[model samples]
Target chain A: MLLALDVMGGDNAPAETCRGALMACDRFPDLEVALVGTGSRVAPLIAEASSSVAKRLHVVNAEEVITMDELPSVAIRNKRKSSLRIAMEMVRSGEAQGCISAGNTGAIVAGGVLVVGRIPGIDRPGLGVPLPAIDRLRMLIDVGATVRSKPLNLVQFALMGGLYMRHVLNVADPKVALLANGEEEIKGDDVIAQARDVLRKGPFTFIGYVEGKDIPVGPADVVVCDGFTGNILLKVMEGLGEAVYALLREEMGQRILPKVGMVFMLPMLKELWTRFDYEQYGGTPLLGVRGAVIKAHGRSKAPAIASALGVARDFVLKRGVELISREITQGGM
Target chain B: MLLALDVMGGDNAPAETCRGALMACDRFPDLEVALVGTGSRVAPLIAEASSSVAKRLHVVNAEEVITMDELPSVAIRNKRKSSLRIAMEMVRSGEAQGCISAGNTGAIVAGGVLVVGRIPGIDRPGLGVPLPAIDRLRMLIDVGATVRSKPLNLVQFALMGGLYMRHVLNVADPKVALLANGEEEIKGDDVIAQARDVLRKGPFTFIGYVEGKDIPVGPADVVVCDGFTGNILLKVMEGLGEAVYALLREEMGQRILPKVGMVFMLPMLKELWTRFDYEQYGGTPLLGVRGAVIKAHGRSKAPAIASALGVARDFVLKRGVELISREITQGGM
Candidate 1:
């Protein structure tokens, strides 16, 4: 499968992105990548690769680059020759099976909708992030793809999220839940309540409402909500993880016994971190779009970018976009 | 200070509730408590207290008990003699300076509004929870008190929450932040955007928008949002904490060296738990009510109950309700 990678968007930019692309090529034998970036920067990295690896990796020159702070609409409109836009265009024109970018989330989401376009029956494309739950991965949809979502939008998110979990994550009859403050039928606001009504009778396996804690606890396979709530939930978890690490380090400093103990605890701590590693999962997929589009985390380095490329490859190979569109059309909820 | 304790509600019930009242009376020299519950169950627990504690603790018979599963509106209207309602009535009648309950949150919120009543000029009462921040305590308001809130309600939450931080928590000119999906001025939904406009012009130290991570990371003293979002954020944190604990325990079991290390690391881990302990802070105050009403966690034990009682005592002593009313009337944003 062929994939387009934006090599000059994220914090670590060309170097990490190029290195990640090479690493992904080594991992996926059949995978071919088009490194979309400036010729001067990307050519040397492509030239340095081993003969077999170099054969799979191609440099597609694009002079301009989209900065992180640029407005999504303005950047997409003005920077036509930008690597992000060029990579997206490759997917739109069917030059590549999928596209991966560690760029501005807003720009990626905008490009997913404006350039690649949404699926036929989908109202708004939702971004689905796979969070590592207790036993398996749980998909949280609309994590900042579309805010100010209506009841219909939430229903769409539920359907799309459920499909992603089932097809991409290989969960049979994925249990879908609407994210709310409480698990009761009468718990959430008007929007959530209305969505719950439709979901109870909708196509997917609706397991009812779930609270925030359910994300980490792994009650449901697909947790659906509006972009605003989902985004907040995602960020809070990230922030809490950082805070816990800081607090633990501070506590470790106060006692000499624990400091000595820390030497033996290093392996266990490494295993714990690996169990909850976001880098290993790669990128969050912008679901409901016509083409396979994966938005990697902005701060992602080589390992994370490579993992994201793997995700994009899996998405394309699994035919996620087609399945979601067909399901939404047939379900007709 | 005279306070009413609802001993009939919560998981631990009369035993923990009565035990907590006695503990609070001992801690606060000027404090007196009226234990509200069934005489049969509550009387025995109170009798076990020391002579001085017994002298200060009074039994107020409340024959009915509100179950956690009951509808808020139905429970408040029908179970008028319920311990939750009786405690609220005590505040309403000026018989107690404030009220504390480790009961159904919906019932507590309903009772605070229906029985204790909303403060004059207050659109809706919000639940303000004191979270342990990096440096000091940060108050998160509207955890579940008022859902389907308007922009006006958020503005009111800011004012009341700010007053709460300044008076009860004792932070001078407390910085207030509106919780949203992003920190950008143009980030949140219509209601938040409108609230942002009012907050920038209205009284208080409006610190623009804050994402979910700010709760643990400590950027603002008072974080205001609709009850729906706030409740989810709060529950997510609780869920995440539990998940982390479980994950770490699992990781520890996998290695023998780490198991030995865990013995010495217990103290550091204990300190970390204490630092993030919600029970030590006691109950969440129901702000914008006519009188002080603190809602303890439903699963609270004796120590948590005692902490909540301490919070209620502080709220009454600090004249939180009166100050909030006065500020809302004068500010009139």
Candidate 2:
């Protein structure tokens, strides 16, 4: 499969993106990676890879890079040769099966929608990220994508999240639920109440309304909500996880006794901490688009970028975009 | 000051309630404690407390106790002589300075609204609970009270939450913020966007739209949002906190080495854990009510009920209701 990688993406980019490409080439020798960015800037990092792995990598020379501060529309419009835009174009023009980026999210999203476009029946595309729950991780969608949404938008999110879990995570017939204040159908606002009705009547094992606490309990497979609530929940969870780890570290470092305890429990703590870490999960996928567009965090390192590339490859191999489009069009009307 | 205490409230119920009342009586000698419940079932617990430091405790005759499973309205309607109703009536008739219950939250809210009524000029009343943040606790209001709210309701929540911080927590001109998905003015839905405009022009020390991560930093004194988002955020925080604590406890209990270390740091760990304990802060107050009505946790113990009563006393003494009513009427127009 031919996958386009935006080398001028993320905080650690060109280096991290280059390393990830090389790593992907090593793991999947049959896979072809087209590194999209200024070839000179990306060459040093790409050269660090083994000759055999480097042989599988191709350079698509794009002169411009989208900065984090630039407005998404302006960046996408002005920098036609930007790595993100170029990579997106590769997928759109059938030069590559999928595209992956760890750059400014707004810019990547804009590029994906403008270049790849949305599926036929989908109203708005959504960003889905895996959250660490008790026993397993749950998928939370519309995380900062589609700022304003209707009941139909939420319905599409549930369908997409369900399909993603089945194809990517290999969870069959995932339990889909609407995120609300209460678990009752009668609860929540007009928007949520209407969404619940529509979702309940639709396909994919509808589980009705799931409360916020249920998100971490692994009770439901696909937890759906508007972008506003979903994004806030995602960020809050991220902040809380970081804060707890920091607090624990500071407290453990204070005294010799606690330090000893930390040393003894370091392995177990690390394993448990891994559950809340998002880096291990790679990046969020912008679902409901006609083509695969994986969005990694802007500060992602080599491992994260490589993971994102792997995710994009999986989507391409499994024909995820086609299946999601079919599901939406079939289930929606 | 006479305070009515529901002896048969919370998961621990009569035992914890009776003990909390006795503790309050001992702490505040002039404060009169009226234990409201069926004298037959409550006599044993009250007698037990009387043997302690609560010889002067008063027991009001009440036959029925609302169960968690019962519907709020049905429980209120059927159990006319229930402990919850009697306790609320005590405050409404001025026989008691305040009412405290660690019972069914919906029933408590229903009883508060039905009995005490909304304070003048208040559009809708809300519940404010202090959440454990990174450094300090922040107050989150409208947690499941009014799920479908307007722009004015959000503005009112800001006013109520601000007054709560100023009077209850003693923070002057507490920075108030409208919780949204982003910091931008154009970020949220129409209701929130309109609320932002209203708050900017109102009496609050209005800090613009705050993201979810901002809650933990305690950047704003008051964090306001609609009940749906507020409730979801509150529950998510609770679940996350519990998960972290459980993980820490498991790690601490792993082996003999960590167990030995745990012994040395037990005291310090206890102090740190207590700092984030919600029970220490007691119940959530139903703000914008004519009289103070505190809703304690269903699993509240003697100490939690006592703390809640103390909160109620402070609310009454500070004349928070009158001040909030005045602010709403003046600022709203």
**For all candidates listed, what's the TM-score of chain B alone?**
0.97, 0.93
Candidate 2 structure quality by residue, lDDT tens digits, A1-333: 889999998899898888888877888877889999999887777767788887789999999999887888779988999999999999899999889998888787788788888888888889998776767878999887887678888888988898889888899778999888877555677877778788877678988888888888747999988888887898788777677667777776776776765666567667876876666788789998878899987788888888888888888778889998788767754
Question: What are the per-residue Cα lDDT tens digits for candidate 1 across B252-287?
Answer: 767799988888888777876776788899789998
Residue B27, model 2: lDDT of 77
Clashing pairs in 2: B11-B298
Per residue, candidate 1 scores C-alpha lDDT tens digits across A200-296 of 9867789999988888885788899889888988998888888878877887777799987888888888877786798999799998887889999
TM-score of 1: 0.98
| Model 2: residues with Cα > 4 Å off, grouped in runs | A73-79, B50-56, B73-79, B247-257
- What does candidate 2's lDDT look like per residue over B263-286, in tens digits? 766776787788787678887998
Off by over 4 Å in 1: A253-255, B253-255
**lDDT minimum window of 10 residues, candidate 2 chain B:** B47-56
The C-alpha TM-scores of every prediction are 0.98, 0.94
Candidate 1 chain B: minimum summed lDDT over ten consecutive residues — where? B267-276
